[model samples]
Target: MSAQRPPLPPFTEETARQKVQLAEDAWNTRDPQRVALAYTEDSEWRNRDVFLRGRDEIVAFLTDKWRRELGYRLRKELWAWTGDRIAVRFEYEYHDTAGRWFRAYGNENWEFDANGLMRKRYASINDLAITADERRVAR
Candidate 1:
């Protein structure tokens, strides 16, 4: 956590934005353990067709994902929210071991604790495109 952590259960849009920003920052760092800490101990996640529960499963899933999706980059946009539940639209691009590029579009539904630790998550994703230029980034 940052030394200047703001009060969670953010009351303003700016504060919520900051919280999401922090989570994304950790996620992009590609350290699964660190990212898992942002969620509650018993958080449940559904990524694509896979279902994962608890922090341990979350960490394992992320590790497996990053291993296969090399040089991944992601951008997340807030879509909707009410109280502790939030929806995000995201895009991610990555290259596989066989040197294939892919851009994936996804939507995530998340519920957070009062302190902003994610408690539940569901993600729907599908590959969008693959192009020569995107592969160059993996280099």
Candidate 2:
């Protein structure tokens, strides 16, 4: 069963939701280059325990991550936001080199520029579950 995405506040909710959807859509594409385009040239971000500064670093980081994580699927939910900052919690499942599977849980704090481009991103994530039958590629 698919869970409905939670609704946002007023005008800001749509904005927040869109930003999240954009991120999820980018992940669904599984293309690091395309996902990097959503951020600013000097965007600041941190994923899992790694810190990434600027678009180039972000691209490099994502590229390396995708290379190691096979059958990677990610989902993000907007937690709360006021103004240009939004907090999101996410879950990701992937398989490693030995075909071992793992699930990760994480929270992200995002800051967007006036143009809706992400400028700052801070994420905190950890493993949650490992399964064998999971069929969803990315939802």
Candidate 3:
């Protein structure tokens, strides 16, 4: 069995908040392998229009993402949770190769296994261009 990432579900408001924060912190690391550990080996994901299956695919996708979206920083808030599922609302700031900044707003739904490894994730996101001076995410 995999080690549990705790604050395991059937969440209270506080625990759900913690879970969201944990996810935010991990994503901020911009380390694909490290962040992939938060999910199950065969975890499935729908990120925007792309579909991914397994940690290997997750790692590859995130590596490509962070490379394209430079200086990424993110914040996530718990929208709701029940049983082994959680919903989150998040915003992230990043710049493209041309140094044009954008803020991405997204919602994610996650379902976790008994050991607290997320088994499924679905995300819908939209990006708004912003001036670098308008950035809200602190480095």
Candidate 4:
């Protein structure tokens, strides 16, 4: 059996918020392995245009993402939830290795298994270039 991540499904406002916060905290760590653990072993993901299945792809994607998106910082808010699904709106700031900053805004729909590990995630994101002074997320 898979380890249960707490605050399992059928979410309340508070628990849903907790779940979102947990995800945000994990992403902030930029540890792809740790972040991938929150998903089911066979998790499916649609991040922007890229399609990913399972932890290995997730880890590889994140590793390459962080490598290019230096100084990454993110914030996520719980948009809504029902049963085993959650909707989230998020924004994140990161600079390229060339030192140009950008902020990405997106919404994500997530479905979790009974163990509270995300089984599927769909995200739509857009990036906007911004000056360093325009940055909102602190390093």
Candidate 5:
């Protein structure tokens, strides 16, 4: 049996909120391995324009992402949920190595398996260049 990361199917509002918070916390840690653990071994993801399959691809993608997107901090909110799926709206801020800061806003739709590991994640994101003073998310 696969490991279960709780707040599993048929989500209530509170559980859905909890799941979103958990994901937010994990992402803020900037640990690619830890974050990838939340998804299934065969998970499918569409992040921005990149398409990925399986944990290996997920890890590689995130590793490169965090390398370029320094000082990454993320916030995720539960937008809606039903059955084994949830929708989330999120924002994150990061600075590049050259010190240009950007804020990314996106929506993600997630589907989980019986064990509570995300099997599918589809994210649509847009990034805006911002001055440091324009940042609202405190690191």
Candidate 6:
């Protein structure tokens, strides 16, 4: 059975920010199963250019991502929210196995079910190469 995530829909600014922080905290853990639990079982996602369906696919994608994005740290801020949907702007820093660092900036639009489980997510992202000395996120 899955966890019943709360603060469901029709959000106030405070609640929306809380939701965004919750998502950021989960992603920072980099635990695929834990992260996948936030989404619906049949969730749909458009992550950059990849399209994914369902929790199994979400888990696989996140597994591949965290594998390549070593030392990942993320920050997400709530931009807007109404009804069961939210918009977020975020930045994350990670290094490749070669130790080359990058800062990725992105915006995501998420739609949730009544139970607060995200059913759809669309993200647009851009990555900039940065020197270790330029890194902003703590390891």
Question: 1-139 in candidate 4: lDDT tens per residue?
Answer: 9999988988889999999999999999999999999999999999999999999999999999999999999999999999999999999999988899999999999999999999999999999999999999856
**In candidate 2, what are the lDDT values of residues 1-139, reduced to their tens digit?**
2222233223287778787877887887788888887787889988867888888998888888889888888888989988778999988888889888888788999877666677799989887556667535453
**Mind sharing the TM-score for model 3?**
0.97
Question: Model 1, which residues run further than 4 Å from truth?
Answer: 1-7, 134-139
State the TM-score for model 2.
0.85
C-alpha RMSD (angstroms) for model 4 = 0.6
Ten residues in sequence with the least summed lDDT for candidate 3? 7-16
lDDT of each: 0.78, 0.78, 0.94, 0.96, 0.95, 0.93
Q: Write the per-residue lDDT of candidate 1 for residues 84-127, one digit (tens) a residue.
A: 67778878788789978898888998787776788899999989
Residue 136, model 2, lDDT: 52
In candidate 5, which residue ranges exceed 4 Å CA deviation?
Answer: none
Q: Give the better candidate number (3 or 5) by lDDT.
A: 5
Q: For residues 1-139, could you state the per-residue lDDT of candidate 5 as single tens digits?
A: 8999998988989989989999999999999999999999999999989999999999999999999999999989899999999999999999999999999999999999989899999999999999999998868
The ten-residue window of minimal lDDT in model 5 covers 7-16
Candidates' TM-scores?
A: 0.87, 0.85, 0.97, 0.98, 0.99, 0.96
CA lDDT, candidate 5, residue 52: 99
| lDDT, model 6, position 56 | 99
Q: Which candidate ranks first by lDDT, i.e. highest?
A: 4
Q: After superposition, which runs of candidate 3 have C-alpha atoms over 4 Å from their true positions?
A: none
Model 5 misses residue 57 by how many Å? 0.5
What's the CA RMSD of model 3 in angstroms? Answer: 0.8
Return whichever of 1 and 5 wins on lDDT: 5
Ranking by TM-score: 5, 4, 3, 6, 1, 2
